[model samples]
Target: MDMLHFGGLAVLLALCAMASNMIYNHFYEMVEHHYGWQRTVRMRVVHTLGFEAFFMAIALPLTAWWLSISVVEALLLDVTFSIFFMIYAFCFNWVFDIARHRLAARVVADR
Candidate 1:
């Protein structure tokens, strides 16, 4: 495929991912609140796995259609991406949480 077409598909996929992520996060927060679950490492792992699984379900068909590939091919590609993103998400959130806590503590100490 040409670069133009590939770029368009990439944008479309990104938009879809953003929408799905919003929906998934809303629901995940609800579940956490209901269960009074803390954002521990195990919870982060679960969150990443759930998001990846949910995203793969939504992206599989779109990817296959965009690339003119078989569903199996799309699954393989999505799985590869999912693995990378899972690690990234885990680390990003972990660091973000630490930073947020530190900032909050500083604010409280200033008062």
Candidate 2:
């Protein structure tokens, strides 16, 4: 395989991962909020870790074969995904909380 091909595949995979993470984070927040599970942040973290592992295992192997790379290389790519997910989950939730608070306060002031 050409070096450029690998680089292109890597960039494509990263973009897809980012899009999926955004979707998943929104879903996770909805589920947690609807169920009033804020007290179970630890459970959420654990669930996210398991979710990341499950996805990486399946995706990494297929990516490795498609990209003609080693499994280790694929796992390295996936580890990057895992870290992205972990950080995104925490930071998005934090920012979301702040935004929600501001919205609520504005509503109160308007009324």
Candidate 3:
């Protein structure tokens, strides 16, 4: 496909992924709150894995259909993205949690 088509597809896929992630995260947070789960390294690992698994389930078939490839081929192609995002997710969440906690603490102190 042409660059324009490819770019549009990329944006569409990204939007879909973002929407799915928001939905997944809402449920995951509810589970964590209900279970009183701390955001430890182990929990973060589980979170990352779960998110990727859910996303892959949605993305793999779409990828295969869009690329006219088999699911296996799409999976192979997605492995790199998965790996990158796994690491990215772990670090991003860790940092974000730290920042969030600090901000919350400051807000409480200012009250």
Candidate 1 colliding pairs, count? 0
lDDT of 1 at 5: 88
Q: Indicate whether candidate 1 or candidate 2 has the larger lDDT.
A: 1
Off by over 4 Å in 2: 1-3, 26-30, 39-51, 54-58, 70-73
Report the lDDT tens digits of candidate 3 across residue range 16-101.
78988899899999999999999999999999999999988988898888778899998998999899999998899889989999
Evaluated at residue 79, the lDDT of candidate 1 is 76
| Residue 55 shift from truth in candidate 1, angstroms | 0.8
User: Which candidate order results from sorting by lDDT in descending order?
Assistant: 3, 1, 2
Worst 10 residues of 3 by lDDT: 4-13
- Residue 70's C-alpha lDDT in candidate 1? 88
| Winner on TM-score (2 vs 3) | 3
lDDT tens digits, residues 1-111, model 1?
Answer: 799988987898889878988999899999999999998989988998898888878888998999999889988877777788789878987898799999999999999
Kindly report which residue stretches of model 3 are placed more than 4 angstroms away from their true locations once superposed. none
Candidate 3 versus the native: TM-score?
Answer: 0.93
Model 3, residue 41: distance off in Å is 1.2
Model 2, span 1-111: residue lDDT tens: 798987887776677666666666677667868988763467656656755765575568778988788999988866776798777865665676678889999999999
